[model samples]
Target: MAQRLVFPDAYAAADLITFAGRAARAGDGAVHLRASGGTLVTAAAPLLRQGLLDSTPTIIGMRLLPVDPELDCDLVVEAALLQIAHDDAEAVELPETAVPPPLWSAAEVPRSGWSHAGTLDLAVLAERAQWGMSAVAHALPIDPGDLIVQAVRGKIWSAPDEDLGGLPRGVAFVARTLGFIGEDAEDVGVRTCGRWTRLTLRRGHVLLRGPAHLGMTEVRETGHVAALVD
Candidate 1:
């Protein structure tokens, strides 16, 4: 039986990248950030970190490749271990073992602008996730339905008065719920995108941001409630 993990949002990809980049950096490994066919490998934490943070929120396919053929089977295992340790990830998938080598590599790489694939996991990613979440949660709170937004350009915005500071409690809760955290309050922003509300913040604002997509409903649902009230 093959397990399929579908991440139908860009935020999901960004989350993976951030998790992977941090793991790679911490282990003194390298990360190659390529969208189509351009392999831009770098070891700079700031650059890779920013790439993960600034990624547009959309759905893209991600395939994890192994650095070596012998390590192929351990790809998913490594990802799970990273998630368990980091607490910044939820799920991952493994490729079919019987697939042809060339095709497997091809599918793992993104084409045009549809999906992306790569390999990582040379170090202990779990600890990085744990520490990152701790740092983020320490600064904010976590809540269901909170929209994680980024502060495109600004400083720490004072938490709103009236107990609406928008921060959450646990770092793991925030990591599991909001894909990424901002560096500070001013770097976080909560906004609604289409049907899904997004919490856009820097890598550090994980806790300080709050939900921005409450009470939202489709036109049909809204009309039904209106009729009932009338």
Candidate 2:
């Protein structure tokens, strides 16, 4: 069975990218990252270590996707052996198999202008809004009762002061500005959008200096783990 592992938020996706990429480097398996077609990252290997993706991990960002209660998982290795071996029967030999790499892809933005991880990735959202605020604004609802605003405030204040330092700058900035509602609701909404840029320093969400593939060297140097397998 092809398993559908959904990352509830952008931070969650970044976490898997770091962990799986590191796992491959440490002889856990192979990992690849592709920026094309949704910034895909995949790790194809049996996790030598156990309990890596367990429990509801603390997410610092709003989740674009639905949450899964039973986060406990043991991605079985041997169960996939036969299918992997069968790949050899094809005319072209099966190059890689059996090892199921932990995978992550940037989920598309939802109807509510919500995102799984990259949803609020500030640059893209802001640029789009700048290009045509009217179009983007139609999709995102900004009111005191909005879910995004509440989620952002809840995540930031709930965490300890020391832990808050590690959050993405954009997110932290938004959290800091909380309760300072602007005279206009639209202005307040824009403020929330401004603070939601991608945070790549501690995690694997990095801005590429040059081409996406070449940029991965920076990620590798940072000891950030991630991969994209075609």
Candidate 3:
């Protein structure tokens, strides 16, 4: 098996992302070296684990490629939303770029590997992440926005017309979304958990409640959480 390239925690990983973005902004050798300090090394390790970039600043003879400004901005935004504190060293408020065409792609910078500490926190993070993910998607030339909607449909529809037999709408919705239910499942109300949230269906309604951590999904069934690309 290969090494994990893990972070002390997701929040720590986020701070490193901000630092790398700023360092990528630096060009001159003096400035670049100045920005590439202990923090930069600490941050790059997790990214290295994900195969996003090489571990060393200079792979062999040549220097590592600099991070794009727009990519940097988006990363800052992403980490900002997930991080616990606002005192990140590279807390520069870059403007949101409009019009399409982001300089980077998902291959160079992955969009996954976020481990949460709490259930409500993960739900809240997912809500915030939707907008960030949208920004990045809008910048993509392929324009996959339509595909995103086709994929997700797990919300409570209090006025639903179909016969769900008093199955808690939210719990069933999540169960279906997670691929735990097929179109023809019966009398089954689902119960599941995530990093910090517990979701259960009882009497046609879903209850979402949890404190945090414990890899909550271990308590639920998911066909697959991630898809293979390429």
Candidate 4:
């Protein structure tokens, strides 16, 4: 993996920074960057399981941006570090050192063969996300332990959205939190390939692999999640 990635312009770099920043705030602070040809794919997990028995489905928010095609790289690094690198006005390339990839990144995701399943109403997604945020907030105690908080979140976010063809509510949460759904945003597109279901919007995509591919053991799970990219 290359240590540096150069965007075509400052505007392009800023776009990635915005995504990384939002992702950092929404989930764990790490972001995965993979380069292929002239495009850079950036992905972040907004909801993930933390243990072997945890039921949370892996939810990834991803976006693409143009980058210099001279180098190809795939790595995970802290979002804050990327922002700090971008802070330097004279730096054209973002410099990063790899961090341990998150477990969700190991899951296998389909690259092609997506068939349009349906469209998700942006208004419905927004409302569901808002309700989820409030539910999580009101459910946690003042000094709730990490496990308890994670459990509560996992349950709420993983609840299937019956109105939206049984897609997990966490998908909506990821889309709204990552700024994928906006006031003027049209209905988000939905597609499926194998066990993977993807919610596509103009800004980016949110992907969810069905529970069957989640893997029963931690090691197996992480390996599968990280296989999202070639």
lDDT of 4: 0.74
Give the better candidate number (2 or 3) by TM-score.
Answer: 2
- lDDT (0 to 1) per candidate: 0.27, 0.27, 0.26, 0.74
Q: Least lDDT summed over 10 consecutive residues: which range in candidate 2?
A: 208-217
After superposition, the stretches of candidate 4 with alpha carbons farther than 4 Å from their true spots are: 1-3, 84-96, 211-230
**Residue 112 of model 2, lDDT score:** 33
| lDDT (10s digit) by residue, model 1, range 32-133 | 222212211111111111234442122111223212112212122222122211222333333343222221122222112211111111121223435444
lDDT by residue for model 4 (42-64), tens:
89998877788787767999888
**In candidate 3, which residue ranges exceed 4 Å CA deviation?**
1-162, 165-168, 183-230
lDDT digits (tens) for residues 145-172 of candidate 2: 5455334433332232222222322232
Residue 18, candidate 4: Cα error in Å is: 0.9
The TM-scores, one per candidate, come to 0.23, 0.21, 0.17, 0.84
Residue pairs clashing in model 4 are 105-225, 105-226, 106-224, 106-225, 106-226, 107-224, 107-225, 107-226, 108-224
Which 10 consecutive positions of candidate 1 have the poorest summed lDDT? 221-230
Score candidate 2 by TM-score against the native. 0.21
Ranking by TM-score: 4, 1, 2, 3
- lDDT at position 182, candidate 1: 30
Model 3 poorest 10 in a row by lDDT: 54-63
On the 0 to 100 scale, the lDDT of residue 41 in model 2 is: 34
List RMSD in Å for every model shown.
Answer: 18.5, 19.3, 19.4, 7.6
Q: Name the lDDT value of residue 17 in candidate 4.
A: 82
**How many residue pairs clash in model 3?**
9
